[model samples]
Target: MSKQQPVLFSIGWNACINCGACVAICPQEAGFVSPFDTIAVDRPCDIACLLCESICPVDTITHVPVEQPAVSVVTVDR
Candidate 1:
């Protein structure tokens, strides 16, 4: 399964009222900020459960597909 990453839209950034709902619901602890600042902290994530997205009251959180590493194949000729 593909892992998801949460993104806070610019519109949501401006609309955010410093509510801790998203930060509290995040299972990965990917988002964090001070009470006065709404800016979220970025971190490496393995699971994107979308808990934060579901908890956002203003619908500011969205999930984007994380790019997976490409696999290389080598063919041998006899």
Candidate 2:
């Protein structure tokens, strides 16, 4: 049987300081920074490793587990 791939997550550019730590530590090479001033993670691989989250000097990056989604709320006034 084939192993299932992990879901990928993206890092916010506003929070990222363009550090290459994520790119270097990723075993999958899933992390990369584009010349256009953006950070990206390859789908089915990103998995929010949090390595970048810890190494970031500015504390701009955050890692959310890919398999989980945040719940949102909407309220209606009676």
Candidate 3:
């Protein structure tokens, strides 16, 4: 069986309202404030937790569902 990759933390910068909710709620301390951008993920989320996704009131943060590859089998006809 093909394995489906787990979803990870993500954010939509365009939709971000500059709210500090994400920065305040993340336990991993992955989020931070930026001078140019309102907030940024300073580093990759090593734990891959969904805390950032749930805390965003504006729904700017989200997770991308992994796409599973198709399986094929070969058959011989006699």
**TM-scores, all models, native as reference:** 0.52, 0.44, 0.50
TM value for model 2: 0.44
lDDT of 2 at 72: 40
Clash statistics: count for each candidate: 0, 0, 0
lDDT of model 3 at position 20: 74
Show where candidate 3 strays beyond 4 Å.
Answer: 1-9, 29-39, 63-78
- Candidate 2 lDDT, tens digit per residue, 22-58? 6566554433544533345443343344565576567
RMSD of each: 7.7, 10.4, 9.9
lDDT (10s digit) by residue, model 3, range 1-78:
113343444567788887777767655433344553434444334334566677788888776553321224323337
Clashing pairs in model 1?
none
lDDT of 2 at 57: 63
Error at 38, model 3, angstroms: 6.0
Which scores higher on lDDT, 1 or 3?
3
- Name the best candidate (by lDDT): 3
